[model samples]
Target: MGGCVSVSSRSTCSSRSNGERISPSCLWIDMFRRKRSRRTFSDHVTTLQHLSSIPSRIFTNGRSSSACIFTQQGRKGINQDAMIVWEDFMAEDVTFCGVFDGHGPYGHLVARKVRDTLPLKLSSFFDSFGSKQNGSGANCCNGNMKSDVADPVKETSTEDRVESLWREAFLKSYKAMDKELRSHPNLDCFCSGSTAVTVIKQGSNLFMGNIGDSRAILGSKDSNDSMVAIQLTVDLKPDLPREAERIKRCKGRVFALQDEPEVQRVWLPFDDAPGLAMARAFGDFCLKEYGVISIPEFSHRVLSDQDKFVVLASDGVWDVLSNEEVVEIVSSAPTRSSAARILVESAAREWKAKYPTSKMDDCAVVCLFLDGKMDSESDYEEQGFSSATLQSNHSGNVVESDDGQNSEPCLQRNFTVRSSEENDQYRRVPIDADVEDAENGGTEDQNWSGLEGVTRVNSLVQLPRFSEERPRP
Candidate 1:
């Protein structure tokens, strides 16, 4: 499989004595560039300083059959949804992809941290397991056995061990990731947490770990030769029976307000401090004792030839677009690399149209090709999505039908994406305090005094009630 990775990783460097700064997500200076380069230190430093002026506005995610990823921030504000696609993640024939949606104050930071470290931890744990399994008569995955060695482990289908190993790896990696998030000296995980939906692909096997509402879905051709979208995740939302049960058993509250009665959210039992949409996640230490957990739900699958690709995305994409619409857009895109971006752009437009009074959610996605090819024909017009818009169902909830026809009241305006240049003011490195207030289910410029009655972990601040009907500033 060919990978299309466009990102070039830069080395890390200490802060210069001179007054200059870079965005936290931007390129870092290489301290050893002078040593590696035949150039002098003065020349390297000069080059580094010159590059510092450019803000990383675009992420060209893959090398170009490598897993592809693209993210677009919504008009809502700062993007807290962080996603990753790592092809050749460790050993050959392995790829790891994940989407993390952060919420509450400092959520972007939490999502970023998890995106950066979770895969590494999983790899490390797998390495340890492999070492321990070596010479134990466990002969699979090359068995690492030398010809001179006495007994070579028996050969078997790759699927057998790969799935089991990853199940353990996902469980361990999530545990270690949560511990790191909790103990980090600089990070405040008290009221913030990130939902994670991740998948590791090796050959035809896929090992998935989900903790929260971020989802993984597969677009495949079924036995009837008809295209179908299979949802790989049961979105761990508060409304799910098992999820709601666990929340209640652990003394947490799960309910919906009159304004948005269809949507249920998790609240702290004692004071309703953090009202989270998902039941499980990494971080949110404040709600840890009350029912929120960092533990992930694990699932494994064997990919068949009919499988075309898998899409992992945050709720921002799901909130606006239905499963079939998402598959239609991705399958019809001009190229696989652009599919994720197209999905995000469409979702951003829908967010504005459907929830006119509410702020949009940040969108991130990882699109992994199973059949490994991009379709040149992007004629989605015939596919029936071009004319589609958001409409109210019988329940009056905003939803776009799979067939691209609106039966109820619909928003018909074509949405314009907020340009990166126009969004520069909202993109912050260490996010502003007000951004925290806005991200944690508050209306823009929503009064902080309205939340004074609820108890919070870090401070007295409480979350303003999140309502889709509230007008955005």
Candidate 2:
């Protein structure tokens, strides 16, 4: 009973004074296993903690001291619109805001992916450009390795340097985003694409990068002390003289349908399919070779006290509401948090009154208030409005899905039809010939025959013969 118990050839446990003995080897092994297990559990918990902290910084629908964002699905299929406001985006003083409107099938996914990734790419490029500028006074431009301004003395003013840095970052990030979309394993972006209007606010300076029809407008008080809408980014439509010329030069057709005489769209040379309403977008590789570029139009604005707020919205809201009207609606909101929701509801109402038959397009809005001050109740009264007037009846339409994603409660529909200035442009066409006939002024009996099935269409009528050669930069 007093003998040592050998648990292993090399180790043993001495007997206690009573009668039993225990193996120290076994106890040591147990303690080591417990420590290793605890370490593994601690690592998992830290990973989960890091993940949980992320959603707080990236907000989809919420209000901050300087910003508020909201989005609603249209009658069209899924909500293809995605939005984000990343507070403290890269630094404590900087914030990133963006709204992406997806088009064609899988447009929602494309929009979401772009919303999540484009900002990261921009941040990376911005940092890289900063490092390069700090180390060697070199600048990147249009894939060129040499600096555009070779003379060091020409690089005058901090504003000019900042603008140059942001411009290069915007261009490189957009190009990288498009390339990533083309090769993405989970995404089929050959026909689907998204319109992006992104803004980075650092101190008093605002850096914007925009492509496609989605718009960013600034609300500022004019000399008259009245609010005015200053459009920051141009709506890059196919009908723009330069845009149309480029498309035509690339053998891409730019024309308006007989039914919608005003809505000029970009079409393929061989087929009457995938009529894109905008001149630029991310993805839509089918049209990339046809002069549809992803290069964003970059702009920088220094904010003043008179600059009230900035509204970045999808074309859906812009299509139905005028810029002035949107400004008025936002300014009239009872609270800053309710501004975006009210604007979207107003757009929805206008859609019903303006185009009774056409499906409402998805609307996403981000309102970034320049000043942190909230409007007093007296401000609403001065505008001759009440809080009740700005409230939206369809506010509850946006519900959290089982996947923890916010989506409108609606049955899945076919492809989407992009409409602008009261003209409908089909992004993807249905397989039905009757629908084609209807679109081409078919018999009166065929009117609205395939309109219900109208959702986002494949941007291609038929897949064109792709060349084996590498794509141009």
Candidate 3:
């Protein structure tokens, strides 16, 4: 005796087996709810899949929507340079870029390891501290700099806070990275190490961290609307005054070799093994005990409308091309995607023409455009001449002399020169006169064994330990 019950003017339902009434409207609503639940579940799965793919966004050697990266192997056995540009690094609108230059037998491995893991560590630190605005996180990041009188929390500006947060992140990440290298089971970092030049761009703010000799520079427009090259990171060579002081204080020796007087290197106290060209780097455990640290120099900058782009590169590029030359080459590029490749090619040609007899060092570059655009038409017309012609014109401007006197552009002047009187202050490991003569007098056809730019030995030889008591000679 079941009969249909009309719930509304447009819908009705029949009685069920239990003699209860049901409305078609209710049934439709229930079905719609179930369908929506399924749809929501599917959306969540899709979101998780996208989140898992974030690592794929890190480009090692390619062009991205906002950046371009390129690397070239040298005559050296293997390419030891590594670089990356990660978009949406930690949060939306943030980007991270880095260039690593490895030196020593296992330098390539060390560089790649840092290139992959460092940014992750930084992101982790940033996230861990981001939640606690006024808690132990802030205090720990600030170290012992908390003011006793004025409230630092209230006195800090927006720029200061951002800089402080990133500064802590860089410091901790670099220290942790070096520690990991020291304890890594598979990697041998005893005498091997890598240089790092990294930058994080969040909106209009830029934070940079650097160690060793790799460099970062900005290409910006001046008041006259002319392109200008601004160096961001100092090359942390062993010859820098503060760097030399720290190494000497830690019982590490710093001096130039007989052949390359202009290049100063860090050496061991008891033995002349593993002469590292830079004052700071990741790995090189032997030198680590002798004041070679892995601490990065941090800097911050607020981007301006005049700012054009940034270029991060290994020492290989810097050794041959000047900062202005690099900026000119990049600005004149026909397209943003081709800028890094063109710059690397220009550096390669310069290396061949500048130091033909020397083995070229590995080159890596990352070019980041700030405004997300390049004036291809203007650049093409401005640089109508070929790269070779531009290079020839640049080379003809000034000649480098033996006395280090050059009318060359002020920025291109070499600063590694140390007077003989200055050299007398440091204890130098003596080299056999015969060996020195052989190296200097060697023929061009002779195969070079050591690294070219830094003059690194192939392997570190362990010398015999001398006894406290001297026997008759």
Candidate-wise lDDT, in order: 0.59, 0.67, 0.65
Q: Model 1, range 206-255, lDDT digits (tens) per residue?
A: 78898887788899998898778877765666655556677899999887
C-alpha RMSD (angstroms) for model 2 = 21.0
TM-score for predicted model 1 compared with the true structure: 0.65
Of 1 and 2, the candidate ahead on lDDT is: 2
Error of 2 at 317 (Å): 0.7
Quote each prediction's TM-score. 0.65, 0.70, 0.67
Worst 10 residues of 1 by lDDT: 24-33
Task: Give one digit per residue, the lDDT tens place, for model 2 in 280-349.
Answer: 9999888888889999878777677788999999888877677888899999887776798789889889
Ranked by lDDT, top first:
2, 3, 1
Backbone clash numbers for all candidates listed = 14, 7, 0
* Model 1 Cα shift for residue 223 (angstroms): 2.7
